[model samples]
Target: MTDVIEREIKIKLDIDPSQLVRNLEKEGFEYLGEEEQEDVYLNGTVKDFRDTDEALRIRVVNDKVELTYKSPKMGKDSKSREEITVNLDNKESMIKILEKLGYKSSYVLRKRRISFRKGNFTVCVDNVEGLGNFIEIEGIDVKESDLVSFFQDFKGKFHLNGEPITKSYLELMVNKLDNSNPN
Candidate 1:
């Protein structure tokens, strides 16, 4: 298992995806292909992951599978956290093992992600199944100021005027489900 600090900022995209791709290309971001991803979030029996603000997820992308644990958000501004991930050979077996260990599946988030890279920063345009389109700027082990500045510059250049969303996809999905099925 390898551990890394993941820092990212998410902005809801209001414009067309093709326009965003054009903007990225004009800014010299290299296309990195696209992939369909499914993330299954799990909850521990001993503790509520929502209350603890931590997450355990099993992610499947094409034929690859990974088990990841994300610590609580580190700061108030961005989604910075310690992420530990292990590549797994079998998704079903891993899910069973986690279930046996008292972790139960909570939610599944599916999205189609188109990726682009320009330096240490990787940009992803995501079309979530139930949610709307979003753009995420991710940096690994980067300084907070640098990440923030990069996002600010990118936002200004791309004419992204909306406020950044700080909530995780899981949080957003949960809230959406709760609101839709208020009983």
Candidate 2:
């Protein structure tokens, strides 16, 4: 079991991914390859995740699967929180366990992520199935107080002038799906 404090700044990108990659490379950020990931978000039986501001999900990245629980945000402006993650070898059995425990699958998110690393921060450029492109800069070991400035500088380097998006990918995707299939 690994417990860590997660912090991230998310920016919804309207620009091309190639341009972002070029800018990042120009700044000497190391490319960390890419992977396709599918995340299955689950709802707790005892409480509503939205009301609690928490999340539980099983993330399947290739043959690896991880079950993660994320607590609510620690600050208003940044996505900082406590994350507990556990790796599982049997994804099918885990899914059955969760289902038997009354945790229903809420949504599934699919994305291809290109990662870059610089210092303690990992920057991921994600192309999501329904939400388009986004850039997420995250770290578990950096100074909490410096997140604002770091995000600003990172965005500045790419000439990104848009406001940062605070909503999680699951939240955004759920809302988008709901809106599209109106009853």
lDDT of each: 0.92, 0.88
Residue-by-residue lDDT tens digits, candidate 2, 1-183: 989988888988989998898888888999999999999999978888989989999999989999999999886777888999999997779989998998888889999999999888899999999899999888885666677778898888778868877788998998898899998
The TM-score obtained by model 2 is 0.94
Kindly report the root-mean-square deviation of model 2 from the true structure over all alpha carbons: 1.3
RMSD of each: 0.9, 1.3
Candidate 1 TM-score to native: 0.97
Q: Worst ten-residue run, lDDT, model 1? A: 72-81
Question: Model 1 over residues 152-180: C-alpha lDDT tens digits?
Answer: 99999888878877789899899999999
TM-score of each: 0.97, 0.94
Badly placed stretches (over 4 Å) of model 1 are: none
State the displacement of the C-alpha of residue 117, model 2, in Å, after optimal TM-score superposition.
Answer: 0.8
Global CA lDDT computed for model 1: 0.92
lDDT of 1 at 133: 96
